[model samples]
Target: MATTRVVLITGTSSGIGLAAAVAAARAGHHVVATMRDTGRADALRAAAAEAGVAERVEVARLDVTDTASVTECLDAVLARHGRLDAVVNNAGAGYVGTVEQDGLDPVRATMEVNFFGVVDVTRAALPHLRASGGRVITVTSVGGVVGQPFNEAYCAAKFAVEGFMESLAPVAASVGVHVGVVEPGAVASEFIGNQGIDLPALLDAAGPYAPALKAYVDRTLAAFGQAQTPQEAAEPIVEALTAEHPPFRVQTSDRARAFVGTKLADLDGSVVQHLTGSWVA
Candidate 1:
């Protein structure tokens, strides 16, 4: 039997976070399944009970963007569990549109959650992680490593996260805290559902680049129309956390792996430029 570990997973209300929580509970870990609203976590709590790990699982409220919530939750967890063995900073969302169409504010919001949110949560949990020699796992995306059409803002946040984790890995390692990232292709999550921003409003407000913005908007919608499911996407994440020594980053889906691989091998940014327009350069 795998040794029991206590894990804290953010964004457990849906998608990969939910799956990771369930998986960890089944693996004999004491799972703290967190969502922004604990009242809405009924399904997750029920699922844990059904999986027979209810006794080992606790549902907590957390909002990664709010530093106070993160600090309070971590404090509560430490008060109860004494130490946290692992932290899965999976609380994030997505937005799809041209940078021009979306403007800086929308991109900033994406960064607030997908990038800074992860940074906030991880920073709050680091002291406990260091104490336990725990691992920090983040569910970034293939987009994090490589740019995609119409996804510049979302991709930018992921890219920032990827870079942040890479830098943090060596720093954390010195203190016995291992940092790893799970880069999945597309998960069947509400991330895309929430990504539906008012493109027309954005375009009308864009003034200068309306035509180009429309083209980018159309492309953004088309690309996400071909995303993978959350369960299938969560496999690589499971592998990363369960391994004796997880790689710094693991590409979950084949499409994600292949897509990212091509970008790395080609070295020609033209393909991405073609998809994302001249802004990619």
Candidate 2:
């Protein structure tokens, strides 16, 4: 029998985080599922029990935005498991607003939760991960590559996270810790419905943008229908976390790969168009 790996996953209260925790437990990994509120983690515990992997999973409180929580959780995990195999920084939220209309406050708030929050958790887990030669898997998005319309704030945050993770990849590898990023396209997670639209108030208070902002936001929201389920997009996350040698970036779902391909093509076209009068059609 194979030895069970110890994995600490954030944002396990619901959606992709929840699904990933369940899947990890089923795969014989001892999963530490961390959510902001333990009271809301009943579903996670229930799911683990239903999968008959309850004993392999533990629900804990870990608010990514809180540095103390990250430290506490990592310490608890190390104290209990003695070895850390992987850390999944999956806690994040999407923001719906244009760059100008939302103002810097909204963008900063988004960064605090999505980018800095991941940093906090990863840094806390690094010691344990390095000791065990473990892996760090960050759940980024397709928006991290190309700027999305309505979610410019969210996109900016994800873009920063992508940059940070890319830069840390070699650093982690040097310490025998592998860093992997899962760029999921539009996963049908509860993120959209749970997103805070109240940022518009801050935008109003900060000032306003041109009428074009509304058009941009509307165009972006229309793309939400293309999202796949969290389960579908997370399969690669599980695979990457467990693989002996994982790729730096794993594009989850067909839409994720398609989005990346389109972005590459667009970049190439722009370069060709700049050099020649005719567009690369």
Candidate 3:
């Protein structure tokens, strides 16, 4: 039997975070599933109970954007469980639109949640992780490697996370902590819907870039149609948490691997630029 790990996951209100939390619990791990607002945990709670692992899963409040909340959540976990065996940084926000259209504020906000949030949670969990030889798994995106068009802010944040984890993985290994990143392609989640972008309004406002924006939107919709469900995407994350020696990077599906592989195999920036530039043309 696999050892029971004390695992903490953020953004468990829905989607991948919720699925990961439940999957970990079903796998015999003690899961602390946290979200910014505990009131929204109904779905997660219901799922856990249905999975028959409800008792092993605890719902908590953790606002990754707030340092105090991150510290307090980790402290409570330690006090309650005495040790933390793993942490899954799954909380993230999405932003869509060209850089010029989205403005700096939106970029900063995306970074605050998608990038800085991971930094805060990881920072707070590292000491305990080091002590227990624990694992750190983060849900990044294929955009982190490929830089999708119209996702400037969101992609930038994911790219930052990829770089941060890649840089820290080796050093963390020295201290007996494992760090891994799970990259998903087009995930069927509320991330896009929650971006709060009004498609009709944004397209009408495009003016000079309307044709390009329309084409990009059409292509994105087609891709999302083939996207993996939250549970399907969460499998790799659960594996990362339980595997004896998980890889530093893992793509959730064959499509994700193919998309990210294009960037990895590119010797020059030419390939990526050509691909992304097509969206604006």
How many residue pairs clash per model? 1, 0, 0
- Shift of residue 62 alpha carbon in model 2, Å: 0.8
Q: RMSD for all candidates, in order, please.
A: 3.1, 4.5, 1.8
Q: Count clashing pairs, candidate 3.
A: 0
Candidate 2, poorest ten consecutive residues by summed lDDT: 272-281
Against the reference, the lDDT scores of all candidates come to 0.81, 0.81, 0.91
Predicted structure 1, TM vs. truth: 0.87
Please give, for residues 1-281, the per-residue lDDT of candidate 2 as tens digits: 12568999999887899999989888778999999989998888898889899998899899999898888888887788788889999999887655554468878889999999999998888988888889999999887887654566888889999999999999999999999899987677778677755535634543444344454444445655777777877688899877878899989877679767766678555642342222111
Pick by lDDT: which candidate is best? 3
Regions of candidate 2 where Cα sits further than 4 Å from its true position = 1-3, 198-222, 268-281
Worst lDDT run of 10 residues, candidate 1, spans: 272-281
Q: What is the lDDT of residue 139 in candidate 3?
A: 95
Give the Å shift of residue 101 in candidate 2.
2.9
Candidate 1 residue lDDT tens string, 18-137:
778887877777889999988888778787778887887789999998999999999999888788889998888877666655568888888899999999999999999898888999
